[model samples]
Target: MEGLFQRELDPRWARTANNASHWATGVLAGAQYGLVAGSVARPRIGYGVPLGAGLWGTGYAVLPAAGLYRPITSYDRATLAKDLGAHLLYGLTTAAAFAALGPARCRARKAG
Candidate 1:
């Protein structure tokens, strides 16, 4: 994924810089996703869909407007669709993993 993103960036940017940016984005995104998941009274795997969608929407729509990235309109349809699908999947899987872990922790605490 970092490689893919690097390819999209300006060629003048060093590989190290692109890698750093990719890592930072991933860390920040994970933190944000975790916060969204934790905010719910009972985090469910299904919640990830909306969470992911929200993030995707913000990234595509807001990021460009804020000068963080190129505008969504500038991307070809295929790229846009690919990004949207990827984000939704990311959200679903992340939420599902969190939901799965949550029950076990609760059960362990109760047993203890």
Candidate 2:
């Protein structure tokens, strides 16, 4: 914000906004995964790796245009790898938690 908007956020507000956005992103991502997983005959935990990598790639694709990040090429391998690793971990955790709930099923009532 300071770099792009030329305005500084209050420390408290920054923390609050950061936390809120993180949680919101996680929830939204989880919802999308749940919907997709629930539709499949058997949702494998491994699918999360691709989901997470796709999300990471998406951020690289979009954030640069938004001025929030440099182009992917600008980052060194280590940096990219670290970020990717974090995303992968998040994806795995999400998949594991969902799997723990047992097989997915549609809870909708049948139309009479």
Candidate 3:
């Protein structure tokens, strides 16, 4: 078990793991937006819905790339509550849009 765990922990695997997860998450997110937009059952939700999805998807994809992107305004209880709520709201909107359309470029690195 020790050897098995060590093999799993190899740094080379990290690159592969992150890249695959990133792209898979991206595509699924786009599909999510497509589903949501379709659920409206309205013919009028054409460009805006899809466009918004793309914006959201891109935001999601790029967010991780930029590093810890969560913005916490303050640690005070009152301020923290407000910040948390706002961040959650922003996160949901960002996720919805990304799941709708964003797909970041991903390429697995060859072993060296």
User: lDDT (CA) for every model shown?
Assistant: 0.73, 0.77, 0.46
Instruction: At residue 14, give the lDDT of candidate 1.
Output: 59
TM-score of 1: 0.70
Clashing pairs in 3: 29-99, 30-99, 30-100, 33-100, 56-97, 56-98, 57-97, 57-98
Q: For model 3, give the 10-residue run with minimal summed lDDT.
A: 103-112
RMSD of each: 5.5, 4.0, 14.6
Can you give the lDDT of residue 67 in candidate 1? 51
TM-score of each: 0.70, 0.73, 0.32
Q: Pick the candidate with the highest lDDT.
A: 2
What's the lDDT of the predicted structure labeled candidate 3?
0.46
Candidate 3 residue 81 C-alpha distance from true site, Å? 18
Superposition error at 83 for model 2 (Å): 0.6
Descending-lDDT candidate ranking:
2, 1, 3
Clashes of 1: 0
